[model samples]
Structures are given as structure tokens and as C-alpha cells.
Target: MPPKAKSKKKGGNVKSSTVMDGLSTEDMSKDQLEEHIIHLREELDREQEEKSYFQLERDKIQAFWEISKRNLDKTKAELRNRSRERDEAEERHRVEIEVFWTVTGIHATLNFNEIPSTGTGPMAPQHDGTATKWYCG
Candidate 1:
């Protein structure tokens, strides 16, 4: 009610007072005041509608985020389980290798070199699980 507000526009050559949305209550007719009130109410309604739309969008995004977060956690847990399984398999393999070497060492110490080589490698057993050809034993 004090006065109609104006915005100042800056330029190199010309200065001006910018017209803003305001009512000149000093000389306003009754009809004008009513129209102004109606416009303001409509603007307020539009703003409230926009706010509601954004709130709904935010809720949808939050729900998606929660689902994605849960999926990520599940994937991480699966990876951890797989890593543990791999480590346990590696440890078992290491123990098996050690046992194989220890048994071979014992055989060597006991003069158990009973099989003859074929110059290619150790002879393959036949289908009956015996050497296909006899060798020094």
C-alpha cells in the first residue's frame, strides 16, 4: 500500500525503472482491486500445484533409490561369498600339493623308483588300469 515497486535496469547508455507486479492502492477502483486479488489467488494456486507435483516426483525418486541401494548390497554380499569360497579352494589346493610332494619324498627315500619311463613321459595305464607294456619294476 505504500507505493508500487519498480526494478532498476542497468545499461551503458540508458537507465530505467522496470514495472513489476504491483497494485496502486492510492487510486485503485473497486473493480481493479477485486481483479488483482483474483489474479493473486490464481497465481498462488498454480504455485501450490507445482509444489505438489515436485513432491510426488521426489517420492518416486526416493523409492527407486532405495531399491537400487538394496540391489547393490545384495551384489556386494554375493561377491564377498564368492571371494571366501575362492580363498578356501586355494587353501585346499595348497594342502593337497604339499601332501603330494611329501609322499613323493618318502617314496624316493625308500628307493621306490620301480616304474620305467618311456622317454616321452610316464607311461599311461591301459583301460584295465595296468601299464599297456611291461617295464622294469
Candidate 2:
């Protein structure tokens, strides 16, 4: 004859249909419950601290990016203005050279070369045609 199987029952009067189904949840100790609560609190605190630090770092990065953008914009504007001035000056210089050639009537045979005439001074002029005329200031 075979041995009898173990019974799985909830209460003394009730009958369970599955094996190892007679366990009850009224058995946790008070110390175990307190330790679980403390662990959960520590985890929450650590997460909150990390969130605060990340927020501060993000703000600092945003500020630095804004400053860099402003500086770049200012630099671009300055470069644009400087280029315009340089182009205008070059156009004026070209017109002045044409007028000088027309007025001087230095022979077409002459090999035109620039020769600075002014000896020395802050206001000294730069030359381009004959030994006497100065084309640049």
C-alpha cells in the first residue's frame, strides 16, 4: 500500500486543494517591519539628493550656453561691419587711382610702380605713381 499524501488546509475546519497552500501571513516580527521601513526611507532620500544636484548642473550649463551665443552674435556683427568698411575703402582707392592716371597722363610706356615718398611722421603719405604724387594716406 502507498503512504497517504500530506493535506494543505487553511484553517483547522477548512480544506485546501493544493499542496504547500496552508501558509498564513500573520507571522512577520516587529523588528523586521521597522528595518524594511528604514531601508525604504534611505533610498528615497538618496534619490531626492541626486535629483537636486542634476537640476543645479543643468541650470549652470544653460547659462554658459547663453553667454557663448551672445558673444558669438556680437563677434559676427563686428566682422560684418568691418568687412563693409574695408570694401568701401577699396572702392574709393580704385577710383582715386583711375583719376590720378587720367590727370597725370604718365605715358602708357611707363612701367607704373608704387614708391612711398613721405620721409617720416604719423601723417606721412604713401605713393603709387611718380616720385612726387602720393596716392594713399
lDDT tens digits by residue: candidate 2, 24-99? 2234356755665687699999999999999999999999999999999999999999999998987897687778
lDDT of 2 at 60: 99
**C-alpha lDDT of candidate 1 relative to the true structure:** 0.66
- The window of 10 residues in a row where model 1 has the poorest summed lDDT is 121-130
Q: How close is every model to the real structure, measured as TM-score?
A: 0.56, 0.57
Looking at model 2, residue 23 earns an lDDT score of 27
Candidate 1: tens digits of C-alpha lDDT, residues 57-96: 9999999999999999999999999999998987786677
RMSD of each: 11.6, 14.0
Q: Which candidate wins on TM-score?
A: 2
